[model samples]
Target: MADASGLELVEQALGHRFSDRTLLEQGLTHASAEAGYSYERLEFLGDRVLGLVVAGLLLARFPDEDEGEIGRRFSALVQADTLSEIGGQLGLADHVRAASGVVNDSILADVVEALIAAIFEDAGMDVAAEFVRRHWELRIDAVTAPPQDPKTALQEWSQARARGLPSYHDIGREGPDHAPRFTVEVHVDGAEPVQATGASKRAAERDAAAIMLSMLDPESHG
Candidate 1:
């Protein structure tokens, strides 16, 4: 396959001049592309790479924070929304190769992970670790306290009331392949199942949990 146009700009943005540009190209191509390529495999490895680096960074930054507290912060930092936010900040939407030639938050997040794997493949984990730390450090610093992610909040709420663990299901999906919306349903023991939609399953599940929490405690909407 021919090189993606203006690959240097992407390199510039990543702060790493890839030795094997094909890896970078593959990272940018979405499954929807006719190029018969996608970032799925790379993203699998990239997800682990990102997790390892971020986990280490979190440990170093919060020496006094406990496991549960650091875990919540790690969850917040590594979520797809954070990845998409960083991707947008880096102007990655313009270069992503998708079916509609457009990149949404979900796709951008995948691309970001794929790019990390590509960097790892091109050079080594050290380089990829550096990339992750450089872009993600500020976000880490900004987490002054561990956040109560909706999933954690809902789980705690349910367990506190002897509801066992809340269940999540991917009840529906709609829209074009390039930009799909997932509808998730969260089931508590006694309450009606709550449904919510988002650009990705995790996000939809989070929203569903948040809705359930809000409904159960109207005053906690903040």
Candidate 2:
């Protein structure tokens, strides 16, 4: 509610200050423009800005890695889930000025991109790149890292072993609509189904598949 406190805290989290005070305010704005001017345009720019910065960082960090490896790692790092996780870690949800009914991790993730766009506009590419670097430094090297999606890995393994395609189902659903908890069952070829729950259906499916993957290949789990 207090702009001063909000500004101070966000600046601390972002490790930079806006020369244009309005840009910072715009970064916190949501598409619910009745609440304020939306940051949607900024988000678009930030998405590309973030991608370029990450790509440059990846190129420098993993010279030995082949193009396919780089592309895969880049995909992993820039996915919505990963960005949303980063947004939550920075407590961007608390700081964003969204409407009363805005309740989704994907929106929070978009806010992160919008915020990055705001930074790029307010400051410059250099500072924006630095901001990305500071937040994503740990993951830069990991761009060359192997895939972490257990479900896909498990599917490949099963297919190789003469098993048919894996299937997943939303077996159970619970909790409120805004934040429903989903239970998923992953069925590997001719194997007993493994179940898992998460905040979303996709996540639940991944978890269920992860458990099956672990059971099928203990080495992958570690």
Most accurate candidate by TM-score: 1
TM-score between candidate 1 and the true structure: 0.86
| Regions of candidate 1 where Cα sits further than 4 Å from its true position | 1-5, 161-170, 187-193, 215-222
Error of 1 at 31 (Å): 2.0
Model 2, 87-172: lDDT tens digits are 88887777777556554676677778888888898888999999899888797654446565776777788888788789998788
In model 1, the clashing pairs are: none
Give candidate 2's whole-model lDDT.
Answer: 0.78
Candidate 2 segments exceeding 4 Å error = 32-36, 99-105, 142-144, 170-184, 195-204, 218-222
Model 2 residue 15 CA deviation (Å) reads 1.5
TM-score of 2: 0.77
Residue range 1-222, candidate 1, lDDT tens digits: 634556888899999998899899989889888787778899999999999999999999899999999999988988999999989988888888887877889999999999999999999999999999999999899878899999989998889878899999888999897899999999999899999999989899999998999898853343
